[model samples]
Target: MRLFLTFCAFFALVAVVFAWEKEDHEIFDLVSSIQASEGKDVNFYSWLEVSPSATTAEIAKAPFVQAYRKKSMQLHPDKNPHDKKIHERFARLGVVSTILRNKESRERYDFFYRNGVPVWRGTGYYYSRFRPGLGTAIVFLIIVTSGFQYAAQHVNSRRDLARIEDIVRQARQVAWGPRMVPVEGQRKVKVNLGGGPESEAPERWISMVVDANNVYFLHPDGDMELLDASTATQPAISSTWFIALVRSSYQSAFGRSNDLKEAEGVSPPQADDDELSGTASEAPGSGTVTPREGQTTSTSTGKRKKATKRR
Candidate 1:
């Protein structure tokens, strides 16, 4: 029984030691994670050292202004174009001056510097006070990452919008239908219907016609039609260059029409091959089509379909 008691005591001691070690390791890990999150060392007092407690008016006085102007001019790309480091220094100086010149920004900056250590409560509140450095680091990382993500998204959005606009502009430029052909040795041009039925207008038509100058359309009856300011005109049978004239006239008229403005307001709908395939297999006049897997439909149908993931 004694031997068993001694053995039990030994195990109790070992268990206490293990618990203590585990707590210590956990604390250490928490500190390390916080430190890793904070970025490189930033001089906390650099702003205060550069801008002192002087009033904005005092800081902007003749001597300070002259010194800043001289330094900025020297660091300007036009002056030190070859020195990248100097350019960065110049930009930093400008930022410093701007902040110092603002009374509120300068006062807040000074408040943090005079305090023993500013406790940032924004993002690292979970870190223990004993690990203040880690907390500060966490906050810094959060701010930097958020700022970078925001800037990247903004830039990407602008690039995408510009690209979309360019594509739409190109599509508009080439929207006219097939070209018209002029009769040989005749001044007039004859538009070939190309076996299409008469009475059917071109697939596309200009609704708001303006002064004829920029665009023309081919009619089903083998004739090129042109819009004009005073009246619409068809080229005489002797006009061998009818197609070119029709195109120019249509361009001039449509270029200034309200159609372009309307087009600008309309956004292009998204197209997916799967949705299109499904629409093709849908029953006619069903009003709604559900596409099965591995299928899509064309754009001609009255119902527009988008690919939806099956549950």
Candidate 2:
């Protein structure tokens, strides 16, 4: 009876020791499981103990396959239920094997291994910067071409504004008897430096205009006085010169720029016209007259009020 009790005590003590070890394993959890895997930087190649550039077929050989199966089972969550990281590692190992075993995926992994990852997408968001295909290239070209066209139109519009402003400056000097004024309440004028579709009116086409005996420029933002014409003078602009300017603008818009030199003889020179009349004359039927460009032909011999009447 005493030997039997001693034997039972020994058996019970062994059971207690085994339970304690199982409890320790449960407490440590994934730590013990992590130790099962080798290497601090166990990439797929190192994990499988294969060449860095091993192909899918090579990796699928009997030896590699056996190693993969054994490792997978050892690190599986079921094998270490109390540990979580080993289960994760086991899952990760499967993914690594898949990537390294496929031709495309393997090439991608190789690239990442060789070169440093991009900082923008460094959080494991592996991606490729693919080249634009034929369709994409065509779309890009279309956008660029449209942008250039709009830019050209914009530039031409600005240039036309400047020239019209010069004419207005000259008009102001002639309208007010070549004198300068700085009064407020300056009104707006409308001038149409016409260059559009063929469907627009001719004489009614507005480019630049005058108000309050002052010459102001007209653009998208309405009338503005960029230069003071009260004292500053400009050469007289003839009907021919104005026509060439408009024609050049129109043709340039249509991708055909007319040479400005061709307009030289087409219009009477400002110097010659001045010598003949010594006063502003309307551009043909413009009806405004003064001592400068595009003035109304109004011979009204009065003070500042009558000046704006010059065509």
lDDT, each prediction? 0.50, 0.56
Q: Which candidate number would show the highest TM-score if scored against the true structure? A: 2
* Candidate 1 residue runs with Cα over 4 Å from true position: 1-51, 116-311
Tens-digit per-residue lDDT, 51-170, candidate 2: 886667988898788888887888888888888567578866777677667787676657645773333332112112345788987777866765665566556656666765666665
Superposition error at 135 for model 1 (Å)? 24
- Model 2's lDDT to the true fold? 0.56
Q: Which residue window of length 10 is worst by lDDT in model 2?
A: 120-129
Candidate 1, residue 108: how far the Cα is off, in Å: 1.1
Tell me the TM-score of each prediction against the true structure.
0.23, 0.29
Worst 10 residues of 1 by lDDT: 204-213
Residues 198-300 of candidate 1 have per-residue lDDT tens digits of 6466533222211222333335664544422223222232232343467788888988686789888899998788567656455787677565755555477
